[model samples]
Target: MDCVKLPDVGSRSLTTALIQFGFVQSYPDYSLFTYCKHNVRLHMLIYVDDLIIGGNDTAAIVKFKSISIGASIYLGPLKYFLGIEVAHGPEGIFLSQRKYALDIISKCGFLGAKPTSVPIEQNHHLALAKGTLMENPNRYRRLVGRLIYLTITRPELCYCIHILAQFMQSPRQEHWDAALRVVRYMKGYPGQGLLFCSDSDLRLYAYCDSDWASFPLTRRSLIGYFVLLGQTPVSWKTKKQHTMSRSSTKAEYRSMVTTSCELKWMKKLLLSFGVAHDEPARLYCDNQVALHIVVNLVFHERTKHIEVNCHFVRDELQRGNIVTCHVRTTEQLADILTKALGKEKFAYFLGKLGIRNLHTPI
Candidate 1:
């Protein structure tokens, strides 16, 4: 009875401890913080109990450990945090989960399988009835679940994992094979990860696109979008529409709606994180009709079925939260999230997404 086990006690304790140590919560609400007590500045990232402390000042970190309701837990040099391997140098930090990727490859038994440049084969369509049912649907479900987590660093798997996740409740043999192919693709660059360069531009830019009627039986389109803070991707999603779109323009416009909302939130986040990006953020889409709809505001038969909520995109465009522009399909970053691609096209997009292998010599 001496110790009380109450809801949020852990969070409260951590918050109280951090403030006592002069660390101010910054990003993700309370997950990341900055400390500047006694002219020593440092940044600390807290993932529950695990912590990653970083800064040029080593003494500030030692002072953080001095306030002891808790013991100092030094995991050392910040190589791995929350399953992401970090390689820090003069250039910047490179983040990867090579160990996690290898574990997924082993669990799915794709160790010796042939590797491919792309996660999904070109024009590969996975329908519900296309393959026979697997005896254990959980097996397929688990593999897809790992792929979903893997997408944190491996965005190329977004479309592939999104497709595989759909059949989790009743996975088929085709789904199993498709999921395995993604694992084999992971084998090609098991150490692939993102690089956040020290000298890269911080201006926010985004690429969004939609694949028209990619789902066969449902006839619903896939929406894909990725927001880049400089050359690094910060936010991305690949999801199937809940309702069917009447035309390619409608699908693409819907994708814009989602991306605009994400951009709005990201803007607010940047300001909260102590970096204000006042320059007009650039949002690129492959569909000209979609960009035109936001700028021109011409209502017509094609735009009739679009819900009222979707018009927030137009509102944001007017306010200049972001500027919508058209890019070619080949250069669209969201393409990786919308559909499968050929080896050459896939490799092109993969590199463009800032995914590089840590094992390779820089």
Candidate 2:
């Protein structure tokens, strides 16, 4: 009956029982588990009782299902799980939360509102925007929370949500208004989501970008990176850096370090899933100076002030674990994450990231 002690107890008990059955975690994270037994390979992702199992051998999966869980339903191919709807075809699988998005819009009472072309305005900046406090902060908090979860399938919402989340403690009218704008933007195309194309070759490629000292209040740069498995985007993060960077190149190199960590973990994860990418992952950057600092030995006096941790990306390059390639600033898909873009630029980057509308024919 105690809530605090229950989760830890349940996790330990579940991990112990699963490990006994030959299922081992990729890391200490009990949520992810894999079991390879007698050519019957199985990968199970467990979040409490919700289990998503996948593998090459269906016989092994069916055998495990019969042995455990007692009751089972085979959906053949994964069409829906959690809140994401999957559309699988010859091209690949498309994941969408269109209905979930619509539900958010309807619940927020923005169903009749005019949809915006961009989530946030191109020149709009929300920094300590002063306005009267909302009568009910709880409603704003709850709405922002729902929008935050939507970033899983909707990357465009990342920056907007990140900005709005800062005001949860005391949401003002301006904050509420900004949050509503994001909801209205979502109304434009509720079916927009990521597309995993089968045509993409099995290679690891990542793009990293930063908006240096863009935050008006903190002056800390925003770091953003997205990793692509072949052409399918799997992981992404848009976060403001913790500390200030003396130079733009330092900010970018810092972003590269953050992205490299993700690439390393993804490689290990793919290996467990039977995807072995022996080649070094390609990392694209729009800043030529950052790439120069990474590949060249001479660290300028200006960049020497950068923390030692940021140089790990340089080490990764030297060791052949990654290759830094130059990409045009206009073609930098990660640009959307670092700053707000207009309709034309936003649409271009959205297409580049392989996120498209999985619109159902009306």
Please tell me which predicted candidate would have the highest lDDT against the true structure: 2
For all predictions, the C-alpha RMSD in Å is 4.4, 4.1
Q: Which regions in candidate 1 have their CA more than 4 angstroms from the true location?
A: 1-9, 26-28, 36-41, 298-304, 360-362
- Residue-level lDDT of model 2, residues 22-106, one tens digit each, is 8888773447778887787788776554567777687877666665433334445566666888887888888889888999999
Q: Pick the candidate with the highest TM-score.
A: 2
Worst 10 residues of 2 by lDDT: 1-10
TM-score of each: 0.90, 0.92
Residue 59 shift from truth in candidate 1, angstroms? 3.0
Give the clash count for each candidate.
0, 0
